[model samples]
Target: MTTSTTPAVKSSEDIVGQKYDRCLADLLVKAGVGFGAGIVASVVLFRRRTWPVALATGFGAGAAYADCDRAFNPARIPGVRVLEKKD
Candidate 1:
């Protein structure tokens, strides 16, 4: 009696779900940092304005989105080359 040797396969849904979770976590962390920075800048530099906080938070979210896009589509990243073997 020989034991079967087969690798477990992950479904596409699982892969997509994992990626989504990662991106969400990244967005939340980056945006939170930006918000904190904005609060400090607003208090010290902008006469306690609200726009700075909003702008900084937006920037953080945008950066996260860009990163997620690149992850989902590596070809969109600049200056990367893929070498193929000539058989």
Candidate 2:
């Protein structure tokens, strides 16, 4: 039987880059969950029907808006560092 040797692998940067992108995607999923939860809590607060309720509603709205912004915003991912290790 004849044997042939395989060529050496090229630079792994591409592979690592792909993995990094995938990890960022995972982080996005988690952030989305948090943002969604905040929105739900905000809605619940809005339903209370009083000044105190209104206060809570405002607080909740603030938190929900912040979280939603984080979830939808791709810019914040760097702060969370989903691909720090890969880089």
Number of clashing residue pairs in every model? 0, 0
Candidate with best TM-score: 1
Q: TM-score for each prediction?
A: 0.81, 0.37
Output the lDDT of residue 62, model 2. 59
Once model 1 is optimally superposed onto the true structure by TM-score, how far is the C-alpha of residue 79 displaced, in angstroms?
1.3
> CA shift at 19, candidate 1, in angstroms?
0.7
lDDT by residue for model 1 (1-87), tens: 999889889999999898999899999999999999999999999999999999999999999999999888887899987779999
Instruction: Report every candidate's CA lDDT.
Output: 0.93, 0.58
lDDT of 2 by residue, 1-87 (tens): 988989877677876666566556655665566556555655676563345444544565555555555655557755665555663
Error of 2 at 19 (Å): 1.9
lDDT of 1: 0.93
